[model samples]
Target chain A: MLSQLVFGAELAYGTMLYYLVLFLVLVLLIKVFAWKPINKMLNERTQQIVSDIDSAKQKHQEADSLAKQRQDELNKSHDEASTIITNAKQAGQKQQEQIVSDAQSDAQTIKDNAHKSIEQERQDVLANTKNDVANLSIEIASKIIQKELKANDQKALIDSYIEGLGKQNESR
Target chain B: MNDKISTFFLGGLTFNIGNMVAATVAAAIVLVIVVWLSRNLQVRPTSKKQAVLESIIDFSNTTTRGSMSDSDAASFKLYGFVLFVLIFVSNQLGLMLQVDVNGVTYVKSPTADPMFTMTLALFTIALSHYAGVKKLGFGGYFKNTYLEPFVFWFPLALFEEFSNFLTLGLRLFGVIYAGEILLKLVGGLAFSNGIVTIIGLAPIELIWQAFSIFLGAIQAYVFVTLTSVYINGKISAE
Candidate 1:
């Protein structure tokens, strides 16, 4: 019974063992070779996504700084224009008072002269304020852009500015 | 039914009824899985079902692409999935069904048989040769194979061929055959003793059987994973 049992078991095993080895070898070979390339592509794609995100972030920072500079320039020009308008108003008031005190010229003529000169001064201030704003805005913009010229850094600033413009356009 | 399931000879090797039925069942199960997964696949992969399927495919795809070139790896993705399902199902059959024919019990896992593994290995090896030949002409393929060693050992070329066949067939056969035999031996020993026999008939047998089923599933996965590795090695340079 023992001999028969052993023989039967061996026969069953011998028949199957050959196939198992073959299958293992084939599987091992394919896994090592064919599968590697697919994995490589996945890794490459992941890296590309990361790089894209980094570039986008840099662009945001650059735009943020450019916007800050533009705001400061606008505020400076507004202050200067207000100072000029206040000084002109004070000079016009003084001339009107002097003509009234002298009593040589008609009161209506003095008032008309004061009004005409004030109007002229207002026109001059408008022209100068327009020119000042233009000049000041250009200088601020250039300074903001030139602050950092590293490839990635510069790209960020430009991207930030474009995004700001885009937002403004969307609002309008 | 007999006519439809006729046995065919391949190089004098006999393929019996069990082999035919098992292979058919394995193929059918695989096809079902593919169709089911195909119908449910989503563009964004949000649902749990879609995510589960995509993850397996994605993991395998990433591994394969890393090993081979892009175009070549893309072509081989589905084959890897098919391999996983087929081997798992085939091994599970042994635990699920045990047949007794003429007082001799046959607990056959398709993978436990050397014939099936050998056939699969031979198929892959032949495919590699075909790929090599296609990439490099027939003359080049033979030249590369034989010319690997110092130019004088031409007679050893046949031995090299035989060794490849032997190693591929034996490795899987040894592992699975040993495992199945070990399980049978343990079960047989338990059955022969009165004390063991009493316990075997109780809930322990069911628990043992279930555990065996799990083992079968795991072994099958291992077998298929190894097969893919071998196939990849043969077809690509790296």
Candidate 2:
């Protein structure tokens, strides 16, 4: 009876309806066993991804702070460098001005010294000319007196007077 | 051709070569695709094809892990691959090929065959028992079965086994077979009637065909998914 019931077909012959039961059993078994693993794996994967994302976000936050601090330090260094450069430039400019002033002072002093030397030389020349003129007058008078004395003593006396006149002319 | 299909096996089983050929071709195509995709899998997804394959793998893995404990989930991968290949091939067989002998042409979808689907379902059910026995020794497996109802209802346990197998096989085979028959009937009518059939029945046939394809794929997925669930239940049980 069970065989008849199992083998019975509503349609034509060769219709194996018993296989339907076998198929259902297979599907039920799969539903209980295979599906569990797949679902378990999915849940685990989702959890893993969630945790990974959280950790990633945390790491990113940490890195962001470090970057900001480094940027600040860099900015500070840049500012310090600019200040140092500005100071150096100012000092250099001051030194250049001082050097220029010193050069001008030295030039002015040299010019004044040259003027004094030229004036001193002019005075010395004038004094030497006056001495030369006096010397020449004295020498010419003595020579004329000596020559007249050789000719005659009286002539020599007149010659002295003439010499004196010549001396006076030379002096003039 | 009909006589060829109805030829006697060792028992009363009728073997259809056309159906078997179509199934074999489909299976071959499935194997080739698996080899092609898996051979080229990369650490990092590249092309759309690779990405699609990787995503499928990833989805399967996640599903396996979610459905079973970590230990059982590892084994679930093989089962998933088998189920996927079997169903995909069976579903695509009729769609891909048409075999004609004399006047009557036949396109037998492998999933439409009760024998093929029944064998698959039986295999799954048997595997479930193996998993149960392996996880909970032979004694424990029997103990769980008895615990379900009154201890005297041991026979019901055997009945339950048959019931599961029946539903799994019939659910798939019935849907596929009926859908195939409907399509054939409608297609024959349309061809014979031409423009008049298109005006009257074409839309209905198209809708049914589309829905049947959807049902076919869904049934395969549901069957495998339930199988995995059962396996996980058996193996993971304390």
Highest TM-score among the candidates is held by which one? 2
TM-score of chain B of each: 0.72, 0.86
CA lDDT of every candidate: 0.58, 0.65
Cα RMSD of all models vs. native, in order, equals 33.4, 10.3
The digit string of per-residue lDDT tens for model 1 on A1-172 reads: 6523532221233323434443454445444443343345446657877888999999999999989999999999999999999999998898888877766566677888999999999988787767766765786588676685678877886677667657745764
Looking at candidate 2, what is the lDDT of residue B137? 94
Lowest lDDT 10-residue stretch of candidate 1 chain A: A6-15
TM-scores, in order shown? 0.54, 0.57
In every candidate, how many clashes are there?
A: 60, 55
Query: Model 1 in CAPRI terms: which quality?
Result: incorrect
**lDDT by residue (tens digit), candidate 2, A1-172:** 5533542221212223333333344334444444444345557767878999999999999999999999999999999999999999999999999999999999999989999898888888778767866776777688666665445766766677678768766885
